[model samples]
Target: MIGSEKLVARGLGRSYGDAAVVRHGRTVLTERLDRFLQFDARTGVLECEAGVTINALIDHFLPLGFFPSVVPGTKHVTLGGAIAADVHGKNHHVAGAFSRHVRSFRLLTASGAELECSRANNADLFWATIGGMGLTGIITDVRLTLSPVPSPYVSVRYERASNIDDALELFHADDHRYAFSVAWIDCLSRGGSLGRAVLMRGDFAPNELLTARQRHDGSRRSPTPRLSVPGSAPQFVLATPLMRAFNAGYYHSHPGAPRTKVLSYEPFFFPLDKIRNWNRLYGRRGFLQYQCVLPSVGGREGLIRILEMISSSGSASFLAVLKRFGEGEPGQLLSFPRVGYTLALDLPNRGPEVFELLERLDALVVRFGGRVYLAKDARMRPETFRAMYPEFRTWLAIKNEVDPDWRFSSDLAVRLRLMD
Candidate 1:
């Protein structure tokens, strides 16, 4: 691939979509540039190379009573990628996106100059780059404010919701009482059982809340995943029937009343991380993650419509998640989160039919004023993207000013017609 009008910088290869890839040209890979530059133990600010992984930061600082303010589902994402996507966490209703915690970063622009972008300096560039999907510039280093933690464990609560209405009501009733919240939805369930979910809310556990044996050490560590997927999955492994059974089993495993427990941070936040190469379970065709957020104004009805459509189409989603977003980060031009509820699902690639189903879902999302998360996107059309991200034009204006040559681009950018 060569002679493309734009280029892209990629790290860790974590984005489920083509945001980190440039099919028409070579892409910049930044994994080897990783380095920890500095840290302020007093204020919990960390300075690290853009290539540094989220897990690296957690490994080095979680024991020190500090952690990244916002962590996406995976710990494999790079600092630059996280900032580029303006990643959010389960606590999005509270702490906001990762860009909100970023103090400053060194950006190498297309003009062959290094600019220090921050909330107070080069403010436009900062916001544009945060969620611009690496089209603004190549981030070299970052200074981010890390959150202080009482311990590596979390005080968790599990509450089961029987349907869409019940889930929404539970979120409304408990969001203000928890620091972190998320719901695992059963998308295949139809009729009265449609949108059944298990809601989990958590807060960092303090020393006083720890057991006697666990309190022996001042610093506790997050647990490693117990199992790993060894080989490629058989073709029929995650088929419709299996996925339905799995979903049913998972839902039935929950208790009737809200149960509280002290669990390690790893299990509480990243259950998918429990297995290595878990994506392989969907077989060689792989899978696609469709994540969309509907506006709070009419989200309930819109979500129900989407769910009913999915159920009627007989498309099974093995992993479906639902969460509420509080608000958009200030000046985050292309960030995905807003005042709404987000639903994310993993659809196994079964052929042309999968795309057809997604296209229908896209239409509904547009009808209800929602947008798909670009970080997890793989096949959204140009017009669909424009409708979802209303700030595309505004982001483009700043992108042209900073990258007049359109130096930063990705496959996702090209497919969405973000390039000139």
Candidate 2:
């Protein structure tokens, strides 16, 4: 804050896009600030530095029956990073986005003055920070409201949907009853099976419902240690034919499968966590994740167009997930949730051709009044961002009031004109 006039405060750099990178200026890496400040176990409220990761929190608190109220697919993200992105999870259809569970946090403004912000005090800053993508100010520490779980295991059920319509029907039917739900969509599928998906639904399991093995494993902890990928898998490994085959096997393996025996929270809620440096699998080229949420109206059409774009382009995505999102907090202007369906795609950086194909998908998202998630974006154009996120301008107005000099900036901010 003192030495650098321009700085981008970043946590674990888990954002798939340039949202966490400083384009030309220096970056104030916040990972070192990690420290567990305080905790109220009974109330499931805890205070910690912005740099404290979700994995760290789980390792320390899960045994006590408290966990993040809403978590994304991975646990490597930090508290500050989560707030910046306003991350959401499979349970978003019921619990809303992560910002709803954040109690308050300490904000370090451009002038290096600290302000305590929340719904009641400095409400603008609170809302701006929730989904403001860290452009408003620098987050230092946060007090989070956690959820109480019966145990560290989940009662899961799997069902395969024949097509996109069936998948939507299944999600709408069961979303109300389950705390968490998501589906793995087969992007490579074509013809009558376009948008075919494997649906997964689950909720925290009560201790009494845990299996003997799970109970013996103390609520089902991970047996294998997390390991980092040394490098990207050979490009040939993800060829369209191979991916199609993998998807076919996966879909056939779980068609109408009965309820699963108990699954641990780590594997269920954070499967990627088991592989420490999974990102490296994308290779030195770095991959991009395109996540977009389309409102219910025209959602099916928009999704179909997106898939069609990918299909015609022959750009195969190895991992794709689709889920429903509920309403979000008031102040979280940039929060990526609404009454709609959200889809996330993992694209390994094959080259310019792949990026060009994504641009077509972006056009389709914008046409349908859907917006791409800033957390996972890497190549979205500034014009497209403005058109998709109508709140972008409003958030910028608030950001200007705090960091008028553009002290807090990132490659994302620069690209999207968050600060000009």
Candidate 3:
């Protein structure tokens, strides 16, 4: 099918955009391809089919002291999706993006050929496929290096920042002391409180830090109850007033002084996963997740301007996050992370107004030498994409060489003219 039809591989559908949707073309689901092919318990090296999910990895290997080297906001994402996005996590400041740990993968090209791709073999294809948004080819399976954790718990410390500058200072001062760090900003706040946030930093809990009962039971956590949104909510459910109230309450809930606690990995990392179908809260119009990274040079001013726009526009986004990135993967051309600060927000799709706000944000990001994350982007313009990712042409060269006919395509690829 790949040889003759325009196609894009879909796995778990976690991406916020149409990267996996081919529009009039075929969509191949990799879910059933799920399988674990190999494992090295001692070295934490494991090879698995593209369909294996972060959730699956945790369930199967957490008990054995291994976890994926990196994870996004959710664990439902498949390995193939992670590689395609080169997803990063709270530890990106240290561990880097997913591509850094990938050893290799088997690619099924459009020419009806299977190629073994890695940093040392078929190296160009290897770099292209990582963060290539699956446009290069179908990733059959992956050899990944899993990280060994001391336990399933994280020793987390929370500190409150009065504003953006405070938050950035806290991050810079302590990021190196922890393996993971992230901040939850109140985008609705303004004036003296603009960008006020609760910064959370953590590292895997060592045995000595675990409670007696926790240590006795391998620090396992009891199953927490899950909640699901039954149906689409009204569009006004996320009104500015309600969002402001929620943000205020959340900001004040955490004490001003820093506090520490040992928490299960679930709450610390995948808090939203506990509420299934949480996107339903955004109503039938859904939401757009805008994630962009601003280089360190002017990131603070950029963030302030961006937040001011969001706050002034009344397009309140309660799920606003901030994180610092170390550097880009050396040879991974299309990967998103760079040495800078990244901000992400969940904006309710309010038709023209919201989109217009995004366009302004995009322009600001570009002015600050930043780029939007393609994995979460849905409405970026072709010219804007070109400006953000100057390396796209290089990636395109490799794509043309491997799939010269442009057999692999997607709605996003077409919209961004990636094939052209």
Candidate 4:
């Protein structure tokens, strides 16, 4: 978005903050850029327009024995957005973030010039764009190294952890054996019962692991409904009582039993993708996803402080996820990955009280040498943001070189003074 002032690079509009919204500014909707430019089945290397989504790629290539090397929970995100955020999946403990799998790409800057960036060439620009959040330029095309898969199905195993300590041991013990993994922690629990969790781990299934019917229809396309949230929902729908009930039911539904089942890529990676406009479920007030990663060294103490803060403040979140992330590429000045446990929470925007509590959480994050995910953040103080992303100065230097006039900007950029 930075180059040529065409400054908006949009994916599925899935980002839960003003980062993806242009407000009154000009925006470039990259969804229209969804098209495969090239593919090499042998090497599993593919090139596509910036707007290409993980879901679209699966539909066209799964039958050919290919899939994203690393994918977040949802496959609806665009290639450009993934790079901009340097998104990670459950397998992060093994493969790191998305940038690792990206070979190279072309970025169109405000001056109407297309520049190639990669580890060996334009290394600085490459790093800045990796996690620059689209501040340096718009991604016109992307070249990524895809991964070979056995079949489109994954063999999944679920294990329940009695508490936080058990969860840690289980994660460390089994992470290497599985290609992908994640744990759903019960953040609402208190005292000795706190941090109870469910661990889900899986690897792509081999041909012999599949049933006759699965092998035949491994390419079958799952129907995706096109729908948006209703204009409004009752404000009372997201009250504390209802949220607590929902959380309780969600926790027990996955009792952590071991089950080896053949699951398709769609259901395993993009369960939420099936529900279009699911955000509307939060109602007219909208919602906010507060996600942060704390370094493992001090992260434990920081997490306890953060959770305790949230519990004491009485903030309610319908969805909360905790995952361990491996080291990531150094580019993308503001990327959100490191050696730590990251947590993401979905809270209905209830007003000033919640924001106040979040501020406290931010303080704890800062104290623990952690940072929030810029892509998912809607509310954060400018000072805190600067402190969290030390590379901001380096990103600014490059952005200024490309967009000195500041034509490419978002509400987030303005709020954080990214263009100043």
Using all chains and alpha carbons, the TM-scores for the candidates as numbered come to 0.96, 0.95, 0.97, 0.93
Give per-residue CA lDDT, model 2, range 31-107, as digits (tens): 88899999998788899999988877877777777888988888878899899889999898889888888889999
Clashes of each: 0, 0, 0, 10
lDDT accuracy of residue 97 in candidate 3: 95
Residue-by-residue lDDT tens digits, candidate 3, 1-420 = 334778899999999999999987899999988899999999888999999999988988999889889999999899999999999999999999998889999999998798999999999999999999999989999999999999988999999999989999999987999999999999999998889999999999998898987777663543544699999999777889989999999999999789999988888889999998999999999999999999999889999999899888979678999999998767978899999999999999888999999999999999999999999999999999999998898999999999898889999999998876
Instruction: Assess candidate 3 and give its TM-score to the true structure.
Output: 0.97
Question: Quick one: best TM-score, which candidate?
Answer: 3
Q: Which candidate's lDDT is highest?
A: 3
Please give the ranking of all candidate structures by lDDT, highest first, separated by commas. Answer: 3, 1, 2, 4
**What are the RMSDs of all candidates, in order?**
2.1, 1.7, 1.5, 2.3
RMSD of 3: 1.5
lDDT of 4 at 62: 76
Give the range where candidate 2 is weakest over 10 consecutive residues by summed lDDT: 219-228
- Sort all candidates by TM-score, best to worst: 3, 1, 2, 4
- Which of the predicted structures, 2 or 3, would earn the higher TM-score when compared with the native? 3
